[model samples]
Target: MDVAARLIGSVRLPGAAALVTGAPHGAPAGRLALRRGDRLEVYGVAELFADAPRPEAAFPAPWPGWDRGVDAVAPDGSFAVFSGQRAVRAVAADGRALWEHRHGCWGPVVGHPHTGDEQEVCGGLEHGSVHVPADGRSVWAHVVDADGPEHWVVLDARDGRETARFPLEDSAASGSHQFSLPGGGTVLLCVGMGQDGVLLYGADGAGTPDGTGPSGVRDLGEDLDRILLDVHPDRPVYLTVEHSCDDLRVHAPDGTVLAGRDAAELGEDRCWDYAAGFADADTVVAVAENGEDDGPGHWLLDAHSLAVLGPVAYPHPVTGSLRALGDGTWLTHDRATDTLSRWRRAGA
Candidate 1:
């Protein structure tokens, strides 16, 4: 047990509308149109002003994850979205172009069948991201080719120029899964599945296989039932929770166990069924709905160890992915609605 919560605060989206991944006004908390069905509708964040959540003046086609730009707020409040078709460009906030880069060849792993390569339809964002940071003029990106579209490349955000790139020769390293780190660097989760193996593309944009870790990937292979993958850029340990009692396991860069803990099990409340993890570089916090009645429950576990430290009651039932914004505050995204809710860890 490392730490616990004392006082907590909670808030929800005003409109009943379901949400899709849109730009989050990271600062004082503003919102944009949430994508639903075929179109986009505006939603509000925490109170931007006494009168917030106002209607967007102009609109464009809605796509999920478009605003996933690291800036928290997209330049001009718009981002490029791949709608299972072409790259649709839209704007919400004041938009600008930073540096941008695109990958050249797809590399060795194109026709590989075991890694689910065929599932990704052609002409999509196969392997590349346009990063628009806080400064509107500076954009950075990494675009890989079709053969091994998931390889990573670091480039100047303003122009689509290749600063450097790392390609995955194995079949498992696919695109569509990326983990953002604290600094400008990113960890591209390239699956080296089948014979390929799992890898982490570090800040230097190099493909480092996780299997070769000092402890070895196979050591935990059979012991693992599920792998919940999330990244905190500051922490060197890769994060995951075991299926039993949600036995927490933290692994170092070379595959050695950093920490492990088995939480005291609740009668019917078990993490093996459902648990959520949020993180930073050093720690990952997991919250589980522990009561037998299916009521909202709370528990905070050290990201490195399975140790359970704090327990609290939630205002609303907890669900979906959580984004830890430090300072005890957390952003919970509802899987069903896709809307974002901000929860402050109860303070002392």
Candidate 2:
């Protein structure tokens, strides 16, 4: 049967990359973060979806452009942490300096002279990202050093002190991003190495099985370059697509494959896109494209069984990748008009 989608609500957000939903440990339940170039606009989730879009607060990001760092907004939209080449700094919403942790620069040039603190490097070949867990007490940062391997460091959210650090053992040429799991106790890290491949890692926070601090980092062993898309809103299972966009799979917290579907199961000559994710607990919304000659297609699958339920029938044309909200709704951004839209199953 065909799964139809209804336009729930949409708002025009210029240069909006994506909408950041609040987790219990992150933003407030009803607040939403819209990430633009160098700042974040916080809005009420209900208000933005209700057609009355007004920014409740604005959080300005720190130095270095978006291309050089992977930053994140605090849970209450009070401040933002930027993971730059030479340091990971936290700045208040009012542009106040909270704290900073300095490190080796990620600049690719070997033996790059460290002239002075005043010297600035704009664009670089390598970079990293950061994530604030649900607990919002510490920041998980991926940083590259000029002399050694890349490391993942846990920083004290209040004073910018380093609590824990681990080497990634992988080279990143295009930077990376971190996804804070719903419970705020675990996180998934994805590092892009340009043409080489992608790397994935997982770690546990405070509430460890043995009441330890945070568990050691574990590599997901992605020989096929798996790109994690999303996690179950209430569970540890996550969604990922192969780097080649050939298949989509759901995996357990321990990196075990729960279920999966490939292009052969989707449609003839159609491959899965990397933007697929959990539309809800029981539904997976994915995009499959049939080459550049054909328009990109959207499909729904049984989240548990990984069965292809059918394609999502939108009322009108919707462009861009589907970003599932995991609440029986998803979002898509029209690059042409820079409009962000939210949708749900019709008659749902």
Candidate 3:
């Protein structure tokens, strides 16, 4: 009932401070997005797992105009997709713009429905960002209209063409996250920060009829403060931390609670890290803290059965979040050492 990981390979990045954006579905299998200073670099997963790891491509952060939010590197490492205040752009490796789509200004002054007071409200993309799935064919962007309705647009990665669009429920601006389904389809989950709800949108591959549409939307009851963590790599299930990390729950796209466990029931007073997600189709890897000065601990759960597989003690303390590679391995960045390391279940 114990899980163990080994240091497969590591890459030292520049800058004292850096951010690791887990590789999306469409990018090359082992590629990772490393943001240092105003620059973003794509590094090979294979290389990071090699005896000697090196970066595959490095470029300035995309969408340099305003504050940069969500972004993805193209699969072939030739281009980058970046999101701005109200636009998403595709930039070439040489820094030339390939295409751009500008939406409505994010924070528009709107009158409060009941109070009759005008206030400025913005959508999540202003701080969060879009997702680029694995096929590398299109980019999924959550865009807000000039009049205030929000829509999810799928754009062609090649030319930024609008291939499909799905209108979402009216909700205040909040961050977003997406998971790729078994096929080339994707499920986009938007977290309404102020509205206190989660919206789900689905889009089939290029050929399906009426592929992009609202799949399910739910207002998680006020008693439960939940955060969407990760999606099952191969199923229609997603993970969330409930009651501010007191418990973990597995949910279906239609808002069905598949299974869950409370911290006390797990024989510990640990708070699950909302940033954790599925390490594979049937397994979820999360971090937990027992209110001790000792660094956080890792937990492996049965994604289907909600069975706790005991705690994992890595050879080295994982300082940052855990991102599954969608393969059997995962990635962890140790800022204390400025090293990006690839990990796999020992003997996995």
On lDDT, the leading prediction is: 2
Local distance difference test values of all predictions, in order: 0.39, 0.74, 0.63
Q: List the residue pairs that clash in candidate 3.
A: 25-134, 26-133, 26-134, 30-45, 123-173, 124-174
lDDT of 3 by residue, 1-348 (tens): 667887776766554133334323234455667655555667666765565545677666554444435567766777877766557778877778798887765654432232222122243334335776666767777777766777777787778878777666655555555555545554444444545654444445444223343233334333355666667767877777773678888876555689997776655666776557777776777777777777667777787977888777579667556676656767677877777776777777
Flag the better candidate by lDDT, 1 or 2: 2
Q: Candidate 2: worst 10 consecutive residues by lDDT?
A: 20-29
For residue 280, model 3's alpha carbon misses the true position, in angstroms, by 3.2
- Which parts of model 3 have CA positions greater than 4 angstroms off? 15-26, 49-53, 59-62, 65-67, 76-78, 107-125, 147-149, 192-200, 203-226, 316-320
Model 3 residue 181 distance off true place after TM-score fit, in angstroms: 1.6
Query: What's the best-to-worst order under TM-score?
Result: 2, 3, 1
Best by TM-score: 2
Clashes of 2: 2
Please identify which of the two predictions, 1 or 2, would achieve the higher TM-score against the true structure.
2
Name the better of 1 and 3 by lDDT.
Answer: 3
Give me the runs in candidate 2 sitting further than 4 Å from their true place.
17-31, 49-52, 64-67, 114-119, 207-213
